[model samples]
Target: MAERLPAGRLVAAQFAACAANHVLPAGIGASAVNLRFLTRCGLSTARSATALAVKAAAGGLVRLGLAGVLLLAWPQTPRLSTTIPRNSLAIPVVGCIAVAALAVALSRPLRHRVGRVARRVLTDVRAAHGRRSRVCALWGGCLGFALLHAAVLIAVVRALDVTVPAGHVLLAYLLASGAAVLLPTPGGLGSLDAALVLTLTAAGAPGSAALSAVIGYRLLTGWLPLLPGLLVLALLARRSVL
Candidate 1:
């Protein structure tokens, strides 16, 4: 009986810790996600939209910084991708800018409606949690962390010496990651690798190259990072911070 109590306490503490560590980032991601959907459904706000955009930008900068680190540590690693033609780069960059401008232009009216919807969603979410709001916050943090991660995955893949278009990689990731939500596994382990490989292959990458890239990415983004997460969870458990 005593043993069981300690185990239970351990689980609860880790859950609490994970939740506590993840709120602001998750809220930022959720707000952006919410605004994206709400805009389509007739709700939007500059303040909310801008907040999410900033979070996205902050997240992007973090990835860019990581890329810079890779350049310093393993100069050859970044060469995994094919060099983009100068002409192609200009067109793609222009297209991305146009899309951003369009999104902003479309947001003026949509933002007002989204604010109301966000308020309503919050009310219901709060009601659903009742006394468990902290748990919800922790989950939100995990979510923020995940969204930031997905963006990084696409970025890393591009930064590697590959030839596929970034847009295609992003789209493939969006679909696979979305599907991974309902997949019954911790961190979508097998599904994510499968999805990434298949998506990359479909985008015209050779089997060997795709496999190598995925393996390298999995090492950095998965196996290596997990050691730390496990260590953190373990230490937290011993300290009864679950």
Candidate 2:
């Protein structure tokens, strides 16, 4: 983060990483590309990985925070319960917590590893927060990106003449994006599409319209950038920048 990296190369690396994301689950492809790029720019591998972890943590936290705020503002929104049935969500949630706790308690090595990773991530988070520039760049970028994606989904819904409220659409998009983390599909391909359509439908959108909106969103966000991203990736590779 302290190094003077070339702005053009940094942008190129991000473009290439987005293209790479379609092949790897979750965001492994992008993370690997960013890690390599940072190391190439003279950062240590450990620092580069920490920077990525911090960025990811910021993104996740921002999504959850925005959703929470929205829910608080519009308590009557039906976006959440439609995704998971009312009165039926508690069992699985509690069961997961119990199972995770039991496993951690039973496994010493796992506990130690978890503790080490947690501490490292916490240290990285703290260090990033200590720097005002890093804090602004990290959280602001994450927040802006999440809002832009939500706005896209809303626009798609409106263009299709869906009747769902903008707040509801925003909340639905956030919830679907959060849920998609569990599936870890490449670039959230099938999982996000399914979750978003389901949520949108539950929020009073017609099923057909919801599906169309999701498809349109994917085309704009995923497919459109893919070819250009790949070209950038190839060029970067040829230049030894990737």
Q: Write the per-residue lDDT of candidate 1 for residues 1-242, one digit (tens) a residue.
A: 00012445434444333333333332333343334433433434543354345445444454444433433554442322222222433465588889866775789766666667567656544543455554444345445664566566666666766787655554445444434333424445666677667656765667777777677767766566555555665565466343
Worst 10 residues of 2 by lDDT: 81-90
Report the error of model 1 at residue 62, Å: 20
TM-score of each: 0.42, 0.85
Which residue runs does candidate 1 get wrong by more than 4 Å? 1-147
Q: Write the per-residue lDDT of candidate 2 for residues 1-242, one digit (tens) a residue.
A: 43457889999999999999999998998998888888888888877887887788789889878977988888876546457543343466688889988999999999998798778767767776778887788889999999999999999989998888898899889888877776789999998999899888878898899999999999999999999999998898888886
Residue 68 in model 1: lDDT: 39
What are the clashing pairs of model 2? none
